[model samples]
Target chain A: MISLQDLTFSYRKGHLVLNNLQLHFEPGRIYGLLGKNGAGKSSLLYNICGLLYPQAGQCQVMGFNPAKRQPAFLRQVYLLPEAFHLPDVDIDQYVRLYAPFYPGFDSAAFDRHLDVFEVPRRQQLHALSHGQQKKVLISFALATTARILIMDEPTNGLDIPSKRQFRKVIAGCLREDQCMIISTHQVKDLDSLIDEVLILENGRIILKEPVTRITEKLSFRQVLSLEETEAPLYSEGALKGYAIVAVNRREEHSRLDMEMFFNAVMVEKEKILPLFTR
Target chain B: MQFSFSRFIHLCRLQLAANRKLYLLGMAALAGMLLAFMLFFLITDDELSYNTQQTIYMIGLVLSSGVFTTTIFKQYAEKSQRTQALMLPVSALEKMVLAVLLTLVVYPLVYTVICLSCLKVMNYIDIYWLGNPNALYWLNASYTPGLLIMYVYVQSFVLLGAIWFRKQTFVKSAVMICLIIIGIHAVHSFLGRKIIGSAQPANVEAVGQKLGATGISNFRYDGGMPYINTLLTASAKINGKWDTEYYMVELPRPGFAIMATVLILVPFFLWFITLLKLREQQL
Candidate 1:
């Protein structure tokens, strides 16, 4: 679990990236953090992982202050940045050197993930392609079995097949006490994967709710025209018609479309705020 | 605030895994350079002596140690590499200690071993191949302590520079060292002029005896002691013959003790600063 109370952060003075922010992440759920460019999603992840310190306020992860970066706290959290550099050593050597830092590291799980990703176990990390390297890092992160796994743009360099494999590996390896937060602009890559969605905007978290709760409150449907609905909160023109988000009056069940849901939250924030505020 | 020897070992292993190739190649190059220097002296000079070999060893040791220390924390100079380094699940103190061990302890030990071995091989070639017995010697007991003290003093600043400057670590550190030396000399000269005055008394022998009593060896009392250059050429009796030898400025016993204390304390001070910098490092 993680808690952020009035977390204010900025790279430079007078230009806040995250301001007076409050958030809590619980275990047993995959969180998809969505935001526009420079919306502090990555900064949030860095603060959670103790890579960056907040200018003000406090961030606690798993009952430890992440800013302290204590060994006990560090061993429980892993942050896979958007860009990372691995040593030139081969896979086994790299694992032998770093895996000991994590007490719960699973070598068998690492081998299985590598097999699933189809990454050669003997290749030097630097010699691998970008996608292959990303897969290796992703696999390594999952194998660490850290309680909190915070990944920024996890699917950026991955090919389509590798992305699917990444999802499969993550889903299969997640334990009940584990919490995974994936921050990305590409929502479709994590479709049907994340249980909760956190939308950040203008240095604040505008929406944070589980998919089921979101779907229970709002209906996502493709309508021929806007006039078909009484009051549509948000709508976008689709190939067949307009994708509309409206209040779910009939208690009907529909799968959540992350891309559409994200857009609706971004555009009709005030309208959606009232539903998820409490 | 915990220290684990096992975790420290893991961190050291991690650094070795990342940089072992570079370290090995660097050692090989150093050995080759030492061999080349020894060969050049043997072939070019009619009489190869231990003094010449000592000079070569000193040069190689100082240069190599400077390079090694300045580059110890090169990973922190770049954003991507820094991220990987900072995110490792080890305490910052462990990382700092590992770096110090490699640059300060392991590097000098390896360099000395390699240099001595190369000297032995060169000596063998001189005695067996070239028919000379005293061409080179493997051991010189006089230089070890002085060389180590100088190495620690120089490496401390270089290590600090590596952490302070993000790029051009060696060049910047070298330049900063030069400036610091020049600044210290300027301040010392100004203070000496102020205290000793610009004129000398008529009793030249009296001034010389006074300075000599204080353990200041190389001073001329013609007009004023304009400057006290650290490097002084002094004439001394060697083998019952007057010989000119280059010596650093000789201070009084108490002054020498102070200098030695500073030399010993500098590395620890710089190392502590580096640890603090690393702990607060942001990427």
Candidate 2:
């Protein structure tokens, strides 16, 4: 659904932000874009949506060049940017004005999503709270029914219940033809949602694998003590116990901790990647 | 892909909604002016002469142009609101086109209608002339459309200025101008004057010859400053011998189309490209 080849980008001259990076994402899966703050995750998502162009290389969504920004191409893609300012008009007016621009805009679905979230459609968007505004944007994005949706830090302003609602709604609303690429530093919010992991570090994608493969090849555990004799693949001492991820030697399916897995990939990247190789 | 006229209209309407306050104010002022003109005509019972009407139109045009320009800066590209607009699915080209149509085409047409209505109410407008709004004496003769196009160019340039400098754009623009002048001189002092060599006069005879008598000389360059200077700098012997066909004022359709496409469309695309670049860096 998306591809980036040797994409190098920079803000100004002599300052490279994204180095020669290559990435690909297929449909029918949720991919988590993992990185620290300012790791270029948002940049990568924007590039995918053709909101940005690279100094070198190219980016494509579905089968079209995102930079070209053809109407048909745009109709199939959506980008929920970190910062958004909705028009001050009431929600219904906003919908009436913008719905015609998108060929696939589903007004009924939009209304349903709004009702599900219990957002007041008659209230002006600016009068709503931060979380409420987010719900509005998220609901509208989902209603677009676009093939590729790129969200950057979608769960940031969301409260606990709303975050769960967000995850649940996203998981339930997606179709097999749809591909959602979510970039977030908050990994636990996407624990059950993401099926694939795409870890970006030092301007390159260092790891890409499915959650199932990662779990089958490796294991995560909370050992009572850090003084265990066998050295684990990766370990960090937590307050309650030692959090460790190691090569799975037993038959049971170990619950994967997305945060621990991300740190393990960053720390023992070389050692962990080989285990997932088919 | 087929361009959707209805979609364009919808986009135009959205822009109108965004600037409803300005629109309401302009409309109210227009109504008040029309009522005042009608009262004057009714009390005096003297036909408002064509010259007076023309003068009124010109003044109205200038005043309204100023209003539209300022509003465009505020409503379309104010810095505080720009970050919120970067994520819409619409491309920069579409957004720019919508803005241009609203500020230039839609706003001007609405103003012209009000002017004609005022003239009609005052019994100063002829029914024959009413059919062709573009045929108004002052409007046609003064090239209001052409001037509006120029204003649009200036507005788009200022939009670029707004994007480049977040705070105090007017000051930053002055500083940039000073730097460019000083930097050019500094570069010339160090490396000699090979780059932007001293300005020189163009030979009208040579230009006319190259353009085949109807070339550069055939166009009337109304731009006062350097063009007037160039005319003054001409050799006495070469005066009147130059072909003047190209110098006459003509309909501004082609020029407006070309400049509007460039001034509005090019920066718009570049802005999108800039947004993308910034997005990557932000990530």
Candidate 3:
């Protein structure tokens, strides 16, 4: 579990990157953090991992102040940054050197994940392509078995098939006590994988809801025109017609479209805000 | 704050696994340089005395120690490496201890072994091939204690600089050390002039005489410097016989004590500062 209370952060003195934000995360669910460029998604992840300290308020994870970076706290949380450098060693050697640091490291699971990703076990990490290296890291991160795993842009550099494999591995690796917060701009990579959606805008979280709740509250459909729907909250043009988001008045079941939902939330925030908040 | 011994051992093993190649290559290079220097001197110099050998050994020790110490925390200089290091589930204290062990203890020991081994080989050549009767003895030197203490004192600054600078650690630390030495000398000179009036004697012998007259039995004059004389003995050769003579050199007890204390304390102080800096580090 993680909690942030009025957390404020800024790289420079005058300009705030993450302003007085309050948020909480629970275990046993995957949170898809959606935000625009420079929306402080990576900054929030760093704050939770103790790489960056908050300027104002408390950011606590598993009852420990992340900024302290104590061993007990670090052992339970792992942050896979957007950019990282792996040592020039084979995967087995790398795992041998680092796995002992985590008490709950599952080598069997690591091997299974590697097999799932189809990464070679004997090649040096630096010799691999960037995508292969990312796969190796992803496998290791999953094997770490930390209670909270915060990944910044996990699906980047992954091919189409690898992306699907990544989603499968992540969904398979989740335990009842584990929580994962993934921040990425590529919403499609994690369409059905994420259970909760957290939309960050203007230095704070504007929307945080479960996928089921979101689908229940609003109906996503293709309409011929704006007049075809009654009081649609948000609408966008599609190839066939227009995709519209409207209040679910008749209990009609519809699958959630993340791209349309994200666009709707960003464009018509004023109209969508009342539905989620109330 | 929770430090498990097994975890610390694991961290040390990890460090070795990652950097063993670099360490071994550096040591090999140092060994080659030492061998070349020894061979050149053995062939060129007519009389390679123990004093000359000791001087060369001391220089090698200081240079290598500086290089090793300045690179101890080099991983923290880069963002990616720093993240990898700090995110490891080990306490900062354990990391610091491992660094100190590698740079201060292991490096010096390995360098000394290599240098001594090279000298032994050179000695064999001198005796067997060159027909030189008096071969150099690598261990017969009075410089070990002083050199080691000085190594600790100097390398502490370099280690701190490695964590502090983030770039050009060796050059920046050298410049900072020079500035510190000059600052201390200037301050000492100014304070000396203020305490002992400007009208005092210009030479050290006169100052020693004045101090002697004031019942300062520990005071002595050596090379235009006044020092506290802790121990003094003299000998002379007269008519092919050695006889007891007047004092020739002096040793200052207070100055030596202060020097010893600083040499003992500064490394720990620097290490503590480095740990605090590491704890506050952000990537």
Candidate 4:
């Protein structure tokens, strides 16, 4: 679990990156953190991981102040940074060296994840392609079995197939006691995988709602024409029809289109957020 | 929370595993370079004194250690590396201890072995193979404790710089150390002149003879290392030629105490600052 209260952060003194934020995350669910570029998405991740100290306020993860970075706290939280450098060693050597740091590290699970990722277990990390290396690190991050696992832009650099496999591994590896927060721009890549959506904008998380609740409140659909439908909260034109995000007032069942929902939040910030607030 | 020997050892193992290749290559390069330098000196300087050989050894030791210390914290140099380093499940104290171990203890010990081994081989070649008229032997050379201590003292600043600077660590550390030394020396000189007088001590007769009048002679204040040196001069006839000798005399201690305390305590303070820097490092 993670909690941030009055969490103000900035790289420079005058400019605020994440301003007076309040948020909470619980175990047993994968959180998809969505935000625009420079929206403090990575900054939030870094703050939670204690790589960056907040300018003001508290960031408590698993009842420990991450900034303290006590060994016990660190052992429970793993950050899969957007850009990471793997050592110039083979996978087995890396595992041998680092796995002991995490008491819950499961070698069999690591091997299985790697198998799913299709990364060669014996090759030097540097020898792998960028995506393969990302997969390898992703596998390791999951295998650490940390209570909190954060992946920033986890799907980046992955081919379509690898991204799908990434989702598969993520779906399988998450334990009930583990809390996974994934920050990514590619919503579709993880829409089916994420249990909750955290939309960040203007240095604050404007939306933190479960996918099921979102589906319960709003309907995502495509219609060739919107003239005959009820008033839509947000709508965007597609090649064949208009993708609309409308209030689910009639109890009609519809799958949540994450891209449509994200667009709806951005465009109808005033109109759409009210539905979720209620 | 702060220090765990088991976790520290695990961290060390991880560091060694991660950098085994770099370590091996670095050891090879250092050995080659030291051997080459020894060979060059063995061939070029036939009349080398113990002083010259030891000077080379000390200089080489400090230089190589400075180089090594400058690179020991490359993990903190880049964003990606910094993440992995800080995220490792080891306390900041453990990481700092490892850095200290590698820079102050491990690297120095291994380097000394390599240096002495090279010197030993060179000495044999000089005496037995080259048949040199004069040969510098390691066993005969005596090192000044000050020089060896100064090596640790000087490299502490480099260690700090390596932690603080992201790039150009070695050169920047060297520059910073020079400036700090210069500043400390200036301050020490000014204070010494003020508290103890600017005049250099001379023998009693030259200053105006007083049987008990005494002040420190051969006084030294190099940066933070302050000393009250005493000199005794003696003359002995060897082969009908007089060889002059001098013996050092003791002096009072109150004035030197303040400076000595600060000077002696600074390495630990610098190391503490380095640890704080490591803890506060952000990416």
lDDT of 2 by residue, B1-283 (tens): 2355665677677777766766788788986876586457445644465555665666665556544534443423442245334444455555555655665567667877888677655543333433323223445555666566555544444434434554566555446545754774565344322321342325656755655543232222222111111211121222346433333222246644664455457546644543443233212
Worst 10 residues of 2 chain A by lDDT: A224-233
Worst 10 residues of 4 chain B by lDDT: B228-237
lDDT of each residue in B1-283, candidate 1, tens digit only: 5678999998888878788889889889999989888899989984356777777777787788888887888888888788777777888788788878877899888988998898888877777877776746565556667667777777777878888888888889999888977886666566554544433335534544644432223322112112222322233333354434332334556755766676567678989998888788877
Residues B93-136, model 4: lDDT tens digits? 89889999999989978888887787767767776777754555
lDDT of each: 0.81, 0.67, 0.81, 0.83
- Off-target runs (Cα >4 Å) in candidate 4 are B46-49, B133-136, B198-203, B206-251, B256-259
Candidate 1 lDDT over A1-278, as tens digits, reads: 89999999999999999999999999989999999998989888888988789999989888888777788888898888888888889999888988999999999999999999999888998899989998888988999999999889999989999888988998788899999999999898897789999988878998889999999999888899888787788888989879888889898787888998888877777898798767
Model 4: fnat (fraction of native contacts): 0.84
- C-alpha RMSD over true interface residues, model 2: 4.6
The CAPRI-style docking tier of model 1 reads: medium
Of the native A-B interface contacts, what share survives in model 2?
A: 0.28
Candidate 3 segments exceeding 4 Å error: A223-227, A230-237, B39-49, B122-139, B198-263
Model 4, residue B76: displacement in angstroms?
0.6
Best prediction by TM-score: 4
Clashing residue pairs in candidate 4 are B230-B248, B230-B249, B231-B247, B232-B246, B232-B247, B234-B245
Candidate 2's residue-wise lDDT over A183-227, tens digit each? 988899998999999888767777788889888888888888767
Of the true interface contacts, each candidate retains a share of: 0.66, 0.28, 0.59, 0.84
Assess each model's interface with DockQ, reporting 2 decimals per model. 0.69, 0.16, 0.61, 0.79
Q: What TM-score does candidate 4 reach?
A: 0.90
lDDT score, residue A272, model 4?
A: 86
